[model samples]
Target: METEKQYVIRCGNGYVRFNLDGSMIGCKYKSSKTTESHMKRLPFNIDLAVASGIIKIEEAE
Candidate 1:
C-alpha cells in the first residue's frame, strides 16, 4: 500500500509553514477578516512557510 509522507504545520500570526518529516536540519493562523487584512501586509517567508506545513517541501521551490 502507498503511504503519505509525514509533515507538521507551524502556523503563526500571518502565515504558515509545512515541515516535511520534521527535523530537516533546521530550527523553526488565521482569526478573521480583519486579521486577514493585516496578514496581507505582513511578509511571510516561503522557507518558513514550507517549514511549517502550509507548502510542501517540493513546493518551496
Candidate 2:
C-alpha cells in the first residue's frame, strides 16, 4: 500500500509501518471504536453435514 493512504488503528491493537528497506518506519497505537454489532456475529459454519451430502453450500451461504 502507498504511504499516502490514510489508515486506522483499533483498540488493543497497533500498527507498524515499514519502509522500503524492510525497516519499521514508525509505530502508532490507533484508537478504533468497537461496536457491539461485531460481537453479535456468529462463528463460521464448520459442520461436516454441510460439506457432505446432507446440506448444500448454497443453503449455508
Candidate 3:
C-alpha cells in the first residue's frame, strides 16, 4: 500500500508537521520553555511558513 507523504518544519523551540496541501497536522516541542499557546500564534500554513522565510521544510521519513 502507498503511504501519504508529510512534511515538517522547525519552528522556534519546536517543530510543525503538515501535509502537501498546506494543512497542519500538529506541532511538538522539545523545550520546556515552549507551549501550545505560543505555537498557535505562529503560522500554520505551508505557504505562510515559506513566505516567512524562517522555517525549513523536510520530508517525514
Error (Å) of candidate 1 at residue 33 is 29
Off by over 4 Å in 3: 17-45
lDDT accuracy of residue 38 in candidate 2: 28
Residues 1-61, candidate 3, lDDT per residue (tens digit)? 9544544567665676544344554466422232333335554554565678766655544
Score candidate 2 by lDDT: 0.31
Best by TM-score: 3
lDDT tens readout by residue for model 1, 1-61: 9543333333432434323333222224221112222323445554565566664422121
What is the Å distance of residue 49 in model 1 from its true position?
0.6
Q: In every candidate, how many clashes are there?
A: 9, 0, 0
Ranking by lDDT: 3, 1, 2
True-vs-predicted CA distance for residue 61, candidate 3, Å: 2.4
Give me the runs in candidate 1 sitting further than 4 Å from their true place.
1-42, 59-61
CA lDDT of every candidate: 0.35, 0.31, 0.51
Model 2, 1-61: lDDT tens digits are 6323243312123433333343333335432222223222314332443355432221100
Where model 2 places Cα greater than 4 Å from the true spot, the runs are: 1-4, 8-12, 31-61
Query: Which window of ten consecutive residues has the lowest lDDT sum in model 3?
Result: 30-39
